[model samples]
Target: MFWKSQRKYMIFLIKNKSEGEENLINGKMNVAIIGVGYWGKKIATEYSYLSKKDAQINLYAVCDVFDENLEFCKEKLEIPHQTKSLKEIFENDEIDAVHICTPSETHYEICKEALEHGKHVTVEKPMTLNSLEAIKLVDLAYQKKLVLSVGHIFRFDAAIEKAKSLLEQGWFGDVYWMKFTWTALMPPMVGRDIITDLAPHPFDILNFLTNDWPNKVTCVAKAHRKGQQEETAHITCEFPNNLLAHIEVSWLNPERKREVQIMGSERFTKIDCVTQKITGYENEKFFDMPNVRSNTIGDELSYFVNCVRQQTSNQVSVNKNNGLVGANVVKLLELTKKSMINQRTEPVQ
Candidate 1:
């Protein structure tokens, strides 16, 4: 049943590969969100809400295969334009960018089409189901000179950002290891398991904290649910500088939890992403660190808009959520999957 997921697979040609500043005209960027499902609705709402205040950005359109989703967007979001055909979004000359929030498997083609049409794109996590497709999207974006960012929202969190700053400042001197736990009890997301569904968040955080990708991975997983996918998974990533990262994810837990523990030579830290709290352990004492709350999803979307705006004006160095980080995340995940299948450590390619 999970394999027979909703949403039809989209196929598009790689036409109009010409690259220029298509995202910005008269200092405004018009964006369309494809797929108004759970995550897509959130994105659309953010964009629509922001569009009212930000004159430089416009939430131009919304698209989804499900009519119910479209109707909901129309009623609640009051979005100016809505469609079931992604082709309309692509074919529209006014839209300067597109957000691909469909299933993981559909990311490659939709993003490829958006870039091919000279529109910037932001695809949700696990950019693609596999690395090959991930690489293709990355390369296509680079070739087209369009911003193709992946939605790794936690990277914009204030707590994680502060924790990363502390780590970089050597507060966590000579970091030896880190542990991430993301587990909860909820209805299983169709076409997703703990590994593919939940692992990307922490894995991307691991990369963000260290600014490095894991060189190797090993995993053990079990499928407790009716799907072929694992409902619980334990994955370990070996990074350089003797850094080891462990990720534990499951849908079998009784309560919801999101926690990260990092152990270093000088001090250690425990972060609760949900509560926006951090506790530092050092010198036989634990103290809570003050954290400023910020809307991560809003920040990420704003950053994406800024990147598109800058890149359109030929300002190339502006850093936004790029595709390479997302690709690396996909590569590491594929490696872990291989390790699970082989029951041994697998080198990340």
Candidate 2:
């Protein structure tokens, strides 16, 4: 049955390719933003800018359940199509791809539907709630020959990219440990927890810098305002070569900070994720590393559109924010939860 479905999907892709070639030739790809709420609005804004700057992309439509969100798209974004139905977006052959900014829990279902409808997808982080569902989506995209990208937006950050380059060059020699501090003063989200909501960025950033995943994880989390879900948490990840990473995420902290610190034998480097600033301390000397900031969301959207235009298959592994990377981060989140519950270190299996 899987093989049969895969064959039919391939045929569908072939037909779609032929029919869509004219648009491709004209360097035009119609894209949609699903769920233009808080985060989705930001995504929509970037796409709106991209549409005006690049003729290749069209901010074709937006889908949201709320009337106000749709209204925002209509008035603010000037999107051509605005609807409250996913069915309408999926059935529309003009929309070449979808950027899903819906809540994390809804990702798997919507992403699956988009792929089944022969649309490329770029779903936000925590691609799904679990690794199993993430892997299934990965496989589906592979079978359909579609671009399946995750919103690991930090990977597109100039500072993060520069840090990766420096680490690759062994500028931070004999790395000792790393720390990620992501804290904000925000009220508890009803159904969301700190680990799933905030930890994805740190874990994904760790993978981005080290080009590896943690072998073991130990996590401690608690809820202060509400007992339903954790509001504050600390996760310790054990990577290969004795590299340790500590991630601190909290909704209780008054100050907002998004920083990554790396301690190495050569220098201690700190990256201000928001400001795109990198500072290093070496031999009692503090120096600022020059880095030009980038609009991460815009770059990420452009990369996804390029992938769609190239018909980049998940099998080719051209995308940095590919499905497998998202799945790995989800697996880490699951393991972190396990460690928190068991009060013991859990191995990443």
Candidate 3:
């Protein structure tokens, strides 16, 4: 039944692409959004807005299994093309790239298929549930000569960029340790736990600021809810130069907080991730740091589009949230789970 519907959809897309070949000749990149749910809708909106300003980009199509989502894209977003079949999107030679905002479990297969069809892909984080799957996607994208990016949106945050600059300039001299607090009170997701769902941001942020991966990790986690998957977790990571980092993620906390603090011999710096605000303390005095906040999702989508264009033109493109970075974060997630299971620190492989 599924294959029959997909075959019809593919034929429809082929006919449409034939009529639209002239548009592609102008070097305009046609992009699609798959899975227009909560987060995917936001990504689509950013692309829509970007397309209005950039003549090189076209917010060409959207795909979702739900009829209401497709309707929303057509009626609300004004996207021209809508389909429920992944095959149709992959087979459409007019689509140069796709933004995948589907569930984490589906990332591996969707990404693999997209790459196999010669389409550039940028997928939401935790690229895949397993490290091996993530690695395979990375290798496949490289072999296909396609741009594969992950939605590590926080790396584009204004506050985070400022923090990285300050650290690079030795503003926080001789950094000691860093702490990340990401907590909220929310109902448990169907098949997701705190580590996989929430820990990637902090882990990736740690790497963004320090430019280093953790050497060892120790984790303690528990489930206070109905499922066996942990809802709260505390991860301790050891990085180079004896730098220690801690990440606390929970779904049980009443107060929602997304924060990061860095302690050093010269000063203490704290970032409010949600507000994009930064504060610093030195000698018992506190001061505000300059932060010009920007929409991170907008920045991220723009960067991905630029990368796609560069790749299409055979130019060297620098992708900060590349596939390898996503794979490493997935590996850390696996090691974190392993540490929790063994009740011991595990060396990062």
Candidate 4:
């Protein structure tokens, strides 16, 4: 029994594990959401819906530059307050955290400003546009003692969650090779490259699914479509323990696809993170793994909000990277571009 439990009677009946008794009502935590665009709307909607199940959280505010979007969210959630400027949000001292789902280019500035406000922060993936800014944000969050979480939404997928648990349990034999494919008729770059906008999800998922940091990176890129940054590309990265991995990301596909295949000596696991389904093959037998029921995006946001309430446990395992992830992303892009440049000079093999 605990005071934190919804039943107030439990506080009086409960005994502390060591001290015998204590009561505390640390109460609800408030969350402020910035951005009301596609991704932001999804996260805010989930946070609002989850709050119904979780009484300890209040989705206190929503902010966006667009008045119509703000109004839509307010009407959708029945919340009375929505603001256009983030100044209105950060001005509220009661707000304890922020989630950013704006454009990739804006990630660094928004996240930096939120951190300086002493608010715990969660921003959509890629960390930032480049490694330098990403490093600064990671370092600053630690300095402020505010929880910093990157919305690596797939990290909350039950398939990867189960994979991590299986790895710990040694269910899969010695691991070997992993292949991931992410194909979509990706949005035109317009102002930013597809590489910058799309690669982070697959990159982060590969890392999460493998539970390893890359040691070396090499890549090949192709730009078949005009005015697009590498409409098709292949990235290969090496991890220690002789584990090899390959990733293919393309905007050229006529159909959307998201898949990961992990190969072990005894078992091979294939998952479609996009569809939230997984299949495994072992000993010449094909089997479907149990359902992966995580509302991953929702779960990720809720987890961040919950950690804000807990106030002690960390949210992201690799929270402080000094922009190593961004650096690696740059390394991959550079290597792929180098390959493309060299391809023009070399004769057919």
Please give the lDDT score for candidate 4: 0.68
Ranking, lDDT, top scorer first: 2, 3, 1, 4
Please give the range of 10 consecutive residues that has the lowest summed lDDT in model 4: 16-25
Scanning candidate 2 in windows of ten residues, the lowest lDDT window is: 17-26
| Predicted candidate 1 versus true structure: per-residue lDDT over 1-349, tens digit per residue | 0001101101121243345443444577898999889999899889987898898888888989988999988899888899988789999989988999998889888888888888889999979888778877866776566788999999888899999999889899899999999999877667787777889899889878887777778999998867787888999888767899999999989868788899999999999998879999999999999999878888999999878767744444355457877877787777778899999998764
Candidate 1 has a TM-score of 0.91
Candidate 3 TM-score, true structure as reference: 0.91
Candidate 3 lDDT, 1-349, residue by residue in tens: 1111223433554454321111112378899999999999999898999999998889999999999999999999899999999999999999989999999999999999998888889999989999888877866765566788999999999999998999999988999999999999999767789999999999889988998788899999999989898999999999758999999999999989999999999999999999999999999999998889989999998888777766633332578898878888998999999999999999885
Report model 2's TM-score to 2 decimal places: 0.92
Query: Which has the better TM-score: candidate 1, or candidate 2?
Result: 2
* Higher-ranked by lDDT: 1 or 2: 2
lDDT values of the candidates?
0.82, 0.87, 0.87, 0.68
- Compute the lDDT for candidate 3: 0.87
Overall local distance difference test of candidate 1: 0.82
Largest lDDT belongs to which candidate?
A: 2
Query: Tens digit of lDDT per residue, candidate 2, span 267-289?
Result: 89999999999999999999999
> 171 in model 4: Cα distance from truth in Å?
3.2
